[model samples]
Target: MNRFDAIIIGAGPAGLTTALVLAQAGKEVVVLERGEYPGSKNMFGGVLYSKGLHELIPHFWDKAPVERPVARWVISALDKEASFSLDYKNARYTEAPYNAFTVLRSKFDSWYARQAEAAGATLLTETIVEDFIYDQQRVVGVKTGREDGELYADVVVAADGVNSLAARKGVIKKDLSPDDVSLGVKEILAMPAESINRAFSLTGNEGAAYTFVGAATQGIPGGGFIYTNKDKLSIGIVVKLSSLSKTGRRPEDLLEDFKQHPMIWPLIKEGEIREYLAHLIPEGGQTSSKSLYKGGLLATGDAGGFTLSTGFRVEGANLAIMSGMAAAETIKRSSRSRDFSEKGLSIYPDLLRQYGVLADMEKFRHAPNFLKNPRLYQSYPELVCQISNALFSVEPGPKKGIGEMVKEARKGKQLSRFEIIKDIYAGWRGLA
Candidate 1:
């Protein structure tokens, strides 16, 4: 009874998607999750891109417990007391077939797991996978913390997350370096739906997503985010793990500081804190993992380092969904002749490419390194704010030209013309 056609570790978006696909194809699949239930330990910035979930369950927003459809995107650069923002809103995004929706992972993942279960996959919750059960060098199953712990299968899928024991035990990837990951701390704040609408300038179910840099992280090489939900807000900051350690500041302390920022405080002043969460995010870009698969094992989601973090945005769930679909496709193809070797699973990368997961990651491979430039989080924002203040102030003797304002802002900052040009060029190359 413990033996199955396939075994999947973790029950996040990635593993559940893989199980859903394979189960629909008539494959016997079992998913093991260590949390009290699916999504119990999961957290994110709250936006779920439509393309991925739509492919799995067409028009999923109709059935899923999503919070709100994102209708506006705002990116703000902040100084100590000033903020410059670029806000974009599209009426089309609020309609059906939307671009993306805000989701509470705890509720969404539970609903998603049920979809997999309804499709004939078995879900075992509160079950920790101790290690992989190997035959020769090929992964066959997992050893769980159950009475009869050993469960065998033809193939094992590791979707256990950034610190995936399945991936490490199966030798699919090595340990993550501090520089390759990021630390994210978040809080869910509850407010009235009407208040949310008025504050963010949204109607009905429309929501807004905001990202902040510069003083948002106190000039740290990281940023803050706020995603509007139906009656709540998801607010957080993500920082480079290596840089965070060097600062001797607590992630929670940073979050407190962000909440008290002049621009952020007003919006969240009436909100009541409902939940606090912290998680490690993979931001290593192309260098996060050494391999995606080995022998009979395949890594997907954060386990495979499939996340993409450009300075302006961070995406993981959509990539996880796509990677999961690719893993399922690879397994189906390999099962045709019963070859689960590393060579047999070589098609996994190609499948990921075909699904557009790897392609997206590859495109932003240099983003991680580019975001490490301290000037982006510190000097640039201060300069821009100073220039803006000078341009808009009425006390100035005579209105100065934009050039004079820029040169004045550059004074005492020690920034050179060539340095500014080089940084602009680098930004174009890395983010454009």
Candidate 2:
């Protein structure tokens, strides 16, 4: 049984960042990934915030496998035949330390793992950690699936993705209900870079991130996303597991429908699907985040439910990197004091709070609940689209006033003013 100072499970951003930090600090760190290689099984709708990564590797865009800087963000409300969009563009985001970048996880995670290796971290692929090795009450290491696969370590960092078995090994409460989890299905559609730039009205390395609500998911409590990735487009739909079950529609079917939407078809009309991938996302905010550290074990990234899925954007990659670094910093401090106990690792969560991760989670804790309202995803979009159509339609009749148009739009709609007011108040309070 080989031993190390730290054993990190999973080689995604969280685990690799932790390994990179700890190894760079001169500590013996080993990262075990169940995939054939890092990011082999990982998938995301693309987009990696640069703040955390910039802190890890300054000027990361110069070295990272970034596809494009996201300078345009579009949020769309889709109806059956019409869609309304809010577009925001900032030229400043095209410069250094940009807001975020589109990335392919398979390529990006591999690059990130290499960075960890260059920092002296050991990476073991095709190694599935079966369970944890416990010295009475404290975790000492992990037992892999390999023959005689017990590898000891002073501390265990569980960076396993959502539905992490590492976090379930008595380190923290792992009761993740279907309501707290989201199933994301995505496709990489191959398209020429110039065609994509022309399609999105973008120039150079600028990319567009479009998020869709309402008809995208057929009123399911979820949304669709599109990110430009150089020669391809990362498009996907994320739906709440519980709500999806009630829809009686497959996620793939929803994705196909979303692609056929008028707003979506024009963007990827002739593109060929290069890859289809599905993954689970932790949608639970602070309410679902249990203890982050216990005994000699610590949980980071999605494993600890350190993800936030606001309607406008789903943010977890940056938090994962931050949590991983926080865990590494805590381990470094603990090593200096020769303490590897739960109390010693308690500083990890504090560091998360200090880095604005936990604070963001707490602040957005109401987002998931706020998003549960069906009207926001269904009737509301249709209403807004109909209103826009009514206001803009150049018919052969006298134009109606704004109030008359609104009243006409509400004629057949079942929604009442009281319901709208109540929902508005609730949404405001929930998001406030």
Candidate 3:
């Protein structure tokens, strides 16, 4: 068996970051990836916030495969006919150490894995860790599918993703329910760089990120997103598995409808689709993230439900990097003490708290329940469009007041002021 200080499963942002951190600190680390290469099996909405990456590798954007810096962010609500949008653009995002940049995971993950390898961490691809080689109760190694593939380590980190097999095998002691996951389907549409700039009205390397509600997901408890790469656009829809099951709508079907929306079609009208992918994402907030570390095992990233989907913002990669670094720090301490027990590894959660991963999780603890509201996905969007239509239309006769226009829009929708008020209060309590 090959021995190392730590063995990390899955080479996504989380796993790769863990390898980089531990290896930089002179700890022998090995990352086992099941894909052909690091990012071959990974997919995301294409946005990477710089906070975590900056900490790991300063000025990473100078050499990494960054698509574009997001100078504008737009959030919109769509109805069958009309849509309401909010756009915010700032020059600060285009400057040094920018806010967030779009990336192709396949390209980014490959580059990230190389960085880890350069730091003296061994990376093995096309290797599947079927199970843990346990010594009584503690995980001392991983059992891979390859011949004589048992690799021993002082500690193992499960950064495998949402459907983490490691977490399912009593390492984390929690079962993920259908309601706790979201099925994300995305399509990569390709176009000329000049054409992309023209369509989005961008100059130089500036980019835009857009989030949509309402008809984007057929009014389901999910949302749609559009992110721009250099010469392509990554567009997708993410919906709760529980909500999707009841709607009887396939994820692809929903994405096709979103692509055909009046406001969305124009942006990608002439672009050719290059690929389509489906991935499972963790949507259960902090409450679902119980027992992140047990014995010599620690779960991070999607495995630990570290993703957050605020109604206005959806973030994960940044938090994944943060958690992975925290895990690496914990493992480094455990290695120094030569104690890889549950008690020795217990500081992982404390570091997560000290680094704000746990704090952010707690702060947005109610986002999952708050986002499940059907009104946010359906009624409110339609209402906003209807009210806008009524307010902007030039009638042949007398015009109605704002109050009357709102009443007229809600007349047939079966929505009331009380229901709206109730949701408003719940939204405040949950998201605010």
Give the clashing residue pairs of candidate 3, or none: none
lDDT value for candidate 1? Answer: 0.90
Residue pairs with backbone atoms closer than 3 Å in model 2 (clashes): none
| 1 versus 2: better lDDT goes to | 1
RMSD of each: 1.3, 1.5, 1.2
lDDT of 2 by residue, 199-284 (tens): 88899889999999999999998899999989999999999899999879999999999999888999987679999999998886
Better of 2 and 3 by lDDT: 3
Q: Report residue 58 deviation for candidate 3 (angstroms).
A: 0.9
Judging by lDDT, tell me the better candidate of 1 and 3.
1
lDDT of 3: 0.89
Query: Residue 111 deviation, candidate 1, in Å?
Result: 0.3
Tens-digit lDDT track of model 1 for 229-302: 99999999988899899989899999999999999998888899999999999877783323998888999998
- What's the lDDT for residue 340 in model 2? 89
Report, for every candidate in turn, its global Cα lDDT versus the true structure.
0.90, 0.88, 0.89
Error of 2 at 112 (Å): 0.6
Residue by residue across 231-262, what tens digits does model 3's lDDT show? 99999998989999998998999999999998
